[model samples]
Target chain A: MGARQTLGAVTDSDSSKAKRATARGRLLPANQEFAVFATVAVCFVAMALTMPSFLTLGNMFALTRGISVLGILALGMGIVVIARGIDLSQVAVLASTCGITVVLLNNGIPAPVALGAGLFIAIGIGCLNGLLIAFVEIPALFATLATGLLTLGATRALVLPQLIVYLGPENAWLQQFGGNLSIGLPIPVIVFAVVALVMHVFLVHTVLGRSIYAQGDNPETAWLTGMPVRPMIVTEYALSSAIGYIGGLVMVASTSLMHLQIADSSLIFDVILVVVLGGISLTGGRGGVSSVIAGTLLIGILLNGMTLLNLDTQTQNIIRGAVLLAAIVVDSLLHPHDEETSKQGL
Target chain B: MGINLSKRLPAIAAGAALSILAGSAMTLAANITRDTSRQAFDTAISGKKVAWVPLWMGVLESEWTGIMKDQFGQYGISLVTRDPNFNNDAQLQAVSQLIDEKPDVLIVQNNSTTLLAKELKRASDAGIYVVQMNMASNYVGDAYVGVDYTQAGHQVADELIKQCGGGKTSGEVALILGEATAAPSIEGLKAITDGLKKDPTVKIVSSQPGDWDANKANQIATTVLQQYPKLCAIHGFWGPMAAGAAQAVKNAGRQGDVKVFAISDGQMGDCDLVEQGLFTKALSNRADVQGITLVNAVLSLLQGKDKPGDKHLFYFTNNYWIESAKDRGYCYKVDKAK
Candidate 1:
């Protein structure tokens, strides 16, 4: 709900309006996605031409690998944003869940068991968040925020002896997710691709997925049409948390340690940035995996280039903020808010 | 039976006589008297209130708090701590409330150079002694207990020059800073910049902020390594975050090529990393020592000799280079407060 207003205001697409436009024989609504994709391409070529190290195989691998974790998280956030819900708790849940998993592994729990229990806890937190938002009628923004704090605090108090939990030497297999796979492609990139493919299939082909979109489009219409609106909302959040668990796993695997301090970093806002930058409309039910991919590429390239240029974090943050502002402006110019489509729920 | 009883009675009587003599002698040897100076010491410190407002309770802050708590308890002083959890607004509120509570001494770790300047002034005006730790504010307090980042940074840079400068290796060095605008980082960077002036051949090829995140450090370090495989040394501001940079170099098979040097909070983890060869050397300002310094400052203030905000005392702590296994004691093991 916090990021929703900020992101939702910049969201250009209204699925219902787009449907009406299509019904009226207009094929093209706007080219926000195209504009973003083109910008990414332009930046890519510019960086490659200017920076000698940009196009190397190693640099390319580094860029994609870095984006994998963020992309996975953005994908999860994209689903919730499509449902007109926000998840401020994703990073917190990810850190705590994966943190507890490593702690268990250190205490002799098998890899599979620890991983399962970790993801189970993550999904459970998501369900609690869903219950609060869907059935208890609390706003998603506040609900996730409170839950995030509760989970992080609880995990810190009960399990983590400190802010960081390092992976023990016994878990070499678990570390493979962060390493290179066959043909030298980083395992995180592979995992991201697999997740994107699976998520794409789920959203396009599943009945529950379609219902999530319908509910986001209009909760009143969705309920009136006898779609299990409450259950769908719960499932949407569960999916977001579950996917976030994968990102957490990759994070721990790659870094060999999970520092809970990351939950307090600006990583979540970056995830939201990728979601919106990819052309996923926070207005709900307007973007998918492709949009997330496009957004990730742009950001991944920008960050990688900035790193190559050795710009300080302050300068990089300035550029990042400017880019987000520019994207919002473009989105607003292309799709001005109309009174009929401006009914707010989140 | 009668003969045995008579013999045993004589022996028992002798033992009783010896016990009486020993008791009297012991009391005579252990004569008790209270010294006026000791009484004055107790009177100066006992029942005094010391309020601590740290930026947050990380490993470093926790160790510092642990030591302060133990020392204060021994001195019969009361200590209260408020953890702002790194939120600036919350810290400001905590300081405001602490001022109203009117503790005899207030110690704080400023999140920035200016956020708590006004409130600190208010506390000083209220006749409270203030001590700042690690990072200082625009408003200097009664005492400052922390490292001189410029000196520490110069030492680190000089160490780097010895390792990679004057055509020893490829003169390329990389810097992984904690935060761009943090006072410690700013001062440290300035010192490093000035120190590098002594060695013209050494080139700083890359500089970026890790924002105190290990993952960010890992990613950036990985990219930098990919770009400059011949990078001679990587200097980082903090230890835990620099562990990621070390790991990145290790993963690239450049661990032997790249020298990793950093300054740490001197927690056990930094020493463990050093022993494991993750860090070539670490210049640590032991948090435990800093905590003890803070206690000493508070105790001095509570002595009621120094005027509040008038006596600007500083306890610039000594730094330790934890390089080999022998430097283990330099890094404190924060298992239990001593």
Candidate 2:
């Protein structure tokens, strides 16, 4: 979720092309993002009318901070989805690896070393998922699903036999990752914003990022143009894991505990939901940072408003399910299934 | 379930003054042959196979298992165990298979009240005495060894009222409960509400389900704290999830100001949180001590001649309030080496 993509980023060479596309494609993901933003605004207005607490500054900060983890995760998921892939193992990898980091820290290891080890393992798992899908020719669905279980099982057997890993008191400063800045913004929200900015620049301004789009659009065509498609897919998954780790760290800082049970819970589904709800298509090669931000905001608003109203879990789930269904319907109408998308069968 | 939270809990209860006596049996002396009662106890318990199926082996379950294993080993009872990990379907399958094995007694830590109700009934029907631990199901086993959660809930509510009500601070309290259908969240909530009825000043502004996840609890806590900056206290149904709520209070710069409480299954980490001042207090269901109670339940079930379904018994483990370092004993240590 980056700052809404602006025309200012368009150079002379791409400006005409961008403007022409922007004009015809109110049907584009950006337009979809606009629709999402409008929906969020509408939700905010409605909630503000009914729930006097909703528009308060404290609640506003809370809403933004609370969505940071989901927003960060959705950004990573956005990258992978843009590359015509999915990583069901994202939560598993993040929880295990980050939990391992806390495990190390609790065991008296230095912070950097613990974090480094966790990062290394996270990237390794991501690479494994990439290799399986790209080289072994396994579908992303089965590959990531299998790897998710494997990661969880291996983690349980090796380090985290229990479901949670509590951060040690000696390393209490690590909590700063989730603490607020002087300006009242949470560190996690800032991190989410920074990550989104970097992702947006990478996606729009980098050769590797451009190649990812081409590869996602059509692997055969991209391969014909010598785009190093396989390696790019590997990079996308690896990057996704790296970003997911950051989100996990923020989560740990906020909660002071990482319960690996999240991997078993419906959390990964929530991550994927945020990603897809933000305009990232399962059919792939669509949506961007702005899309993710829009989706996260809408969800964040919905969740915050519900909690302020003290809605029960079942009611929240029903509302979430309804919103998700509506988004899917809106998405399909905007990006009609073609030969390729139909083949993908999202 | 450190579900990888932390490796804690040493042999906290093994050598404690845990009197393992059930029915006519008494604690055996060192010289067993000199005592006919010891011999009789040995005869009744020895060679008996007790099978256990937990939701998953979390710190609480492990603590109970360790005590059971050591005691059962000494008594010559063969304890068969299955770990379904966390899958409800797998738990059902394992219970079915264990029932077929026809162990003398079957112990299950039900994930939900209904998931294993029928299986428990079938096990009882199969002549296998059933022992339900921590949480009970619809089908009453031969014996149950855990908290009378409604009573526990009343205690929690009373504690919350004492800490936050009577216009002490902001009487607004938030509850981050476990899974909605779980006994702790459902019955515990109702009882807490029932208890809170005594305090007209106390207001429960938000009661959200954390689904027993710390992160979910943290998010909900953050929002609730924001909505009521003067929120006097936050109560969580479980410790790990409450840690998240505690952190949110800390993040919001309201640690001592916003009291945080959890009804914890006395894990070392739960105690550690109290020691660190993250939690104002915790109502610890002494899991380590519960292990002794669990062993007693199983032994009684074995020695009794009544039919499984006919001899319905409930052993409510006493709960302790963990407020300081001295109360840390209430929390069990994990068998990290194991």
Candidate 3:
């Protein structure tokens, strides 16, 4: 009996030790979490101090609404970047697809049908990008870049050639998407929030989501483990394009105009900046939804504060660039490279 | 599916046939006309394609293009257009490619005077008729069809001089420029400076470029208010942007103390802003008249009545000041119902 009790105690000790190790591995370090939290806190305090109206609810709502489209786009971009791939064509896909939808609706197509067709078109572009990158073995960057130009050119050629399709008065259903929910809160904010929640769940709860991380971490290992790596890559880009389409829709709604120029704007760079700044490693397989939110909030706060402070556009641009650089430096410092994960195409 | 297929088949067939017919008609039209302007327009353009590029096809450019397209399109005139969506390089490249296409007429809206000067000269020497629209270029083309910006600038400066120039009202004045290097902005600024020379007591306290952005104008006005407590008047180069500047003044609790002035393309937004007392005054350029004039010019050119360099044809549209809320007609507004 004595021997059995001693053995039981030893077994219990081993199990508890194993459980503690697993917990430690699964959760982020407290110090690291604290540092991130502190960065956000510091940004908020700085903005509040500089701009008298920065802390107001109206301004906060406006800032969130303004960043919603970019944030949504970055969520998908973050996913693609996490999978060891980049999509330069995301904005182009959004513009072309969204532009098509607006033109179709203007020509009397039903709203639902136009939206479905637009989203499909975006996915098709994404699939094309995937085929070139995965099957043809073109570099992701070049493939997306080429695809972006093609999409933009095709849009110009096929759609309303050089016209601003005004949908503000024609489409009430579409306009409602851009309208405020409760005075200050816009529908775009809600859309982004819902999307962020779903993406968080998807990344945490699903088998495919895990595979994305695995693929990003080590593509060969993922393939060796019987994962459908090529198809998965296609799906990843498809998701990005689909999300980009939604972002475009929100953009048209917010701006009250279907501008073909959005794709060519500095918007894509801003999206990527948000992703990278939020602690999502461009090397892939590291960051998730939380990182995106943090990055977006930081940027949104900075821009809102600048707006409130009445900073000139040039000065605002300079400050934004500087902040992005600082964020990158901080991220690099925090996540020192590990040889196994840092190499390209892993 | 069968019903949809049948419906689409006829539509597709009609589209194809219509396109083919249109193509043949254009070809036939191209073959029938001869260049009447080549000898006279030779100095302006003789050996090159004139690419008329605008920010985009809007009511303003459509009128301009209607004239050019009708006249130029019939005369075997090879006109190319690049819709830049207000982008700078796209405009530059369109001009460059037109140079490559070698047309004889290159009419353009200077996105800014300096951005396309080198290319404009290249087109000129390469032998292209370079007619600049409402804006001037650093490199003067053979002809410029636009307003005398300096005159407009002086007009506004004189008005401000009467109201606030002489330490009589507050001695503080603000200037809002469009894009920094825009030809109109530079010309307007120079004219205002020249006019200010006549009024020694007018102290211009703040001058900044709003980039022709309405939101930016508002923000700039906000900051200027913070900097100058006794700003008596504000002058802006564009209508919509000026309205935004006015809004900022109003928001800062200085609407009566600060007066806003601007120049506009008679867009309804400017008129509406004016009516709302967002602006103290706005100089209006009738974009509708401009458009109609452009169409008329194109028709005249196409009818084989005039050559390119025979004489410089200028259309100087009237500019009016909307000094009161009741003066809405002075500015142009696009009817949403239309």
Candidate 4:
């Protein structure tokens, strides 16, 4: 497995350790999520004090809406990351599957059936990825990357050879999902919330979710303990792909068109950034749903503020990179690696 | 007639035949110029190699390639096209390899202003007629044929001013750019910035790079709208990308109130947007006619005796303002069968 070198992953989250971490102070929390939330709060306060428009209801909706699709994708990425794996194909899968769904819709397929077919294709790709990573024993990163490319090429050849697929007016129902609610909540933000809540429940309250953590904590012991790790691997990837499809649909709804070139964009990196920024370890087994939400909000706030300031992309990217690096450094300082984990080196 | 009938008949017959021969000879002389021109064109264009490297075979590039094949193939010109698929390095490699083949003409559509600048210059230095189509590089090659992006941008800004500037509405316009480094974005913004100088009331509230991704444009527009609720208009650099901004405005329920403008290569989708009122205006760059312009540029270069890279021969493409259904011809229909 191409397990990347990351910081000493906290494989245990026992209450004793949590109480001790709490005793340490308000400066450090039991996990990465609290620190991220605090960061968002402080930044929000700082920004609001300076800019009158920063705290408006409409701006809040705009900020959340901007990151909702990314947050949705990160939810899936979070699941895969939790299982000690990475899926580079999330963006690619979404781009192609969503484009195909629109094509079907244009060809007189009912919205449910067409959308379901797209979901089916996405799950199929996820299975292929899991098969390669689990049964074939390839690295998850390479497996998903290849499958993503294959899916994009196949979709282009079979359905959307053109780079863009515009939504027809007959499918106006789908566009409604992109609209904002009367209460000023963009539908995408609500979609992210529902998906996040479901994902949080799945991770916190289910046997399969616990098994994913166990599997990521120690794969060999998990298998020896009768966890059926291989099947779980397939399930997580399918979940990832399926969630990615939903995000893609939202993208279609929001944009009124899907540009296949998005697969070629840097969107996947941003999704992973949202996941990892909130402390989802690449080595896995440590983070949870709060981590994903925190990450989304942090990135969303930063991006929203930058947009409001009218900063250039380069400056925004620089600030983003520096903040991520600084956060990681601060995290490492706060939670120094133990000798055993350092020697094991993931 | 009584003296020598047969002899006189011979003379008269010869005279009539002489006059008819003279008449036919004049007709032949009149046809010679047209025949020679065609012959000259065939001689100049036939057996010549034209290598076209599009930024990638997207819709516009494909349309150009299709037209070139149908026209160039007729004149016995062999066209070798390499689609870099929007990758700059691959494009550079393709142009370099084509230059090595010493084609009589090289037509390239650049994705960047400088990716192929060196290669284009080298090709010209090697005596290959380099014609940059639609998008050109920083190093001016021989005979550039593409949009007068500045003029197009000025016209668009002037239109925006009429609709939104000079106390027309909010005087707030946002520009959703693709790549700031791209020629279209750079020139368009420059011209728009300059155009706004004439009307100080027309303030550009926010300009951001959407990177030509519709989703990005959507997100940016959503945020900008929140920041400037009364944003009068938005100008998206390209049609497909701007479609996102239009949708964002529509999502904000400002479809007719907040105008959206886009510059498109007349992809029917853009025209469809205008027809549906999603887009307030579209500056249509007719790629179909642009293909003809490109062909003529190649033909002119091939027939001329001037050395490659000696001087610039440029053709600024025509821009048609598409606002209503009557201007549908400004848009070119794509073969979905492709």
Candidate number with greatest TM-score: 2
Give a tens-digit lDDT track for model 2, residues B1-338: 34211212332333222223342234332333434655666677789999999988877787778878887887788998899878888999999999999999999998888998988888888998999988899888888888889999899889888888888677888999999888878999899889999998987889999988888888899898888878889999999989998999999998898999999888888889999999999999888667877877777766655777887788887888989988766777766543
Candidate 4 matches the true fold with a TM-score of 0.90
Q: Candidate 3: where is the Cα deviation over 4 Å?
A: A1-37, A335-338, B1-63, B75-104, B122-129, B147-288, B291-315, B318-338
TM-score of chain B of each: 0.89, 0.90, 0.73, 0.88
- Candidate 4, residues A90-166: lDDT per residue as tens digits? 99999999999999999999878998999999999999988888889898978999999999989888887667889
- Clashing residue pairs in candidate 1 are A1-A141
Give the least accurate 10-residue stretch of model 3 chain B, judged by summed lDDT.
B37-46
Task: Considering the two chains of model 2, state its CAPRI-style docking category.
Answer: medium
Of candidates 3 and 2, the better by DockQ: 2
> RMSDs, each prediction?
10.2, 6.2, 12.1, 10.4
The candidates' interface RMSDs, in order, read 1.4, 1.0, 6.6, 0.9
Docking class of 4: medium
> Whole-model lDDT, candidate 4?
0.84
Candidate 1 CAPRI classification by DockQ:
acceptable
Candidate 1 chain A worst ten-residue window by lDDT: A1-10
For candidate 2, what is the TM-score? 0.91
lDDT of 1 by residue, B104-189 (tens): 99999988899999999999999899899989999999999999999998898898888999987888999999888889888998
lDDT of 2 by residue, A200-227 (tens): 9999899988877777666778889888
lDDT of 3 at B16: 40
**lDDT, candidate 3, at B226:** 56
Clashes within 3 Å, all models in order: 1, 20, 19, 0
Candidate maximizing lDDT? 4
